[model samples]
Target: MKAVVVEAFGPADQLAVVERPDPEPRHGQVVIAVEAAGVGLVDILQRRGEFGFSEPGFIPGVEVAGRVQKVGEGVDRGLIGQRVFAQGSGGYAEQFVADAAGLVALPDPLSARNAVALGVNALVAHFSLRRAQVRPGEHVLVRGASGGIGLLAVKMALQLGATVTAVTRSTAADRLAELGIQNIVRRDRETEPAGPFDAVIDPVGGAAVPALLGRLAPNGRYVLNGGAAGFPPPEFGMALVQTFFNSLTFSTFSLNSVPAGEAGAAARAIFADAVRGALVPVVGPVFRLTEAAKAHLALEGGDAFGKIVLEP
Candidate 1:
């Protein structure tokens, strides 16, 4: 099998595709013939040692979509040929070992490529909005609204009957419009959106935190899911203080925090929606599995317009 190995944690250059012996499924696990894997900001951060938990010689993918090639003890034999998407480790390779219990069977119409794109990203969006307690007829602003999670966040907000204003780059304006988002705010613009939003879904946490916080309506909810641009500036604390009178709420979410059973149910619902064409996962650049370094570079550099997928 060919797998991307991180010899050291430093930069995208640290990722190299090298040949490795095929892995066998462990008890309760299945070996997936990986068809597509997602490259996310979390992977980039992990590669750069920003997370501080990852060491060298690690495979850096968490979500994958493929067919089950083999199953270990305690797993169903019928699962061998099942098409599914899973959230597990070592996905940036031609094959990945994932727990059979955690695999969500993919609908026949959903391609492996699209499943990988929607898997974790949609889960994040779903859980974030649900936590924010988003209600119909409310107004929501989505920062980084053209990215993988952001795009899904926009759709999810609309499905909840919220009026959505997208904050993204001009390069993604057309795509945002295609999703029927009319109130688009350019991130490059000096001025901020005229917001008083009921909720804000921010994936790009940075200096804009203070300003975005100020735009929130009284009793508004803000959910921070990722920091692709980096963490909020030191002034964010004072920003929170400044918004104190509004009775605002700020939260941070990770899918890891959700119980496995609940997350699995949500993932199954998301897959069903994708099958029904209610949710469309946008795929940005497609790269060969061996080109993991380049894929990481594209994601880290903000050059990715949608969910980046690496195919084996």
Candidate 2:
């Protein structure tokens, strides 16, 4: 088996492609013959040593879509050859092992490529909308609406029958328009868009929170889960003050806190909606497994429009 190894961990070029031992499932685990894997900002950060705890010489990738080749102790043999998506470390390889508890079988209608596209980003958006309790006819604002997760939220909010206000750069207008999202704002503009939105889905957090709060309806909910602009801004007190003054709701979403089984269930639900033509994932540039380093470069340079995938 071959894998992308973060050897020295400084730049994208440091991600080396090398032969590695094929992974075997331990008790209660499953090994996948990976078809595709998703590249993310976290992968880039790990490549750059920004994640201080990530040491060198580790295979990195959190989510992947493939077929189950083998099942371990206490696992059903019937699961073998099932097309599944699982979350775990070492996804950037031909063979990856993960907990069987985290695996979800994909219906025949979905492909491995599309499954990887709709992986984590879509899950985060789904959980965010649920936390915000977005309802039909409500007006929702989505900041960073052009990014992978932000764009997903825009489409989901629309499906929920909410009026979506997408805040993105002018470059994204044509793309958003193609998605039927007509209400778009230019992020470079100094002025905020007019809104007393029923909910605000903010992926770009930091000093922008206070301004986003102003857009929400009096009793509206604001779901903060991403840090596209950056995290832990100099101050976070404004949300506290605003939440106190208004009968507003502040909520959060994290895959880490939620159990793996729960995440897999939600993903299957979303995939069913996808198969029904209710939701579609936007896939951008793709890389071969050996080109993992270049994929990280494109992501670091902000070139990925929706989801970046690696085909093994």
lDDT of each: 0.90, 0.85
Model 2, residue 217: C-alpha shift (Å): 2.2
RMSD values for the candidates in order, in angstroms, are 1.2, 1.8
Q: After superposition, how far is residue 71 of candidate 2 from its true place, in Å?
A: 1.8
Per residue, candidate 1 scores C-alpha lDDT tens digits across 1-312 of: 999988898988889888899999989999999999999988887788887355788888999999999999999999988998998878899999998888899999999999988989999999999989999999999988889999999999999999999988888888789879888988776467878999999899988888888889999999999997889987786777887899989889888899878989999999899988899889999999989999988887776788999999
Error of 2 at 172 (Å): 2.2
TM-scores for the candidates? 0.97, 0.94
* Residue 55, model 1: Cα distance from true site in angstroms: 1.6
Clashes of 2: 0
RMSD of 1: 1.2
**1-312 per-residue lDDT for model 2 (tens digits):** 989999887888888999987777889999999999999766776777776335799988889999999899999999999999888888899999989888888989999989988888899899899989999999999987877789899999999999999988777777889989999888776466878899989887877787777667788898887766676454565765756766888776676777777888899998998899889988878999999988888876664678889998
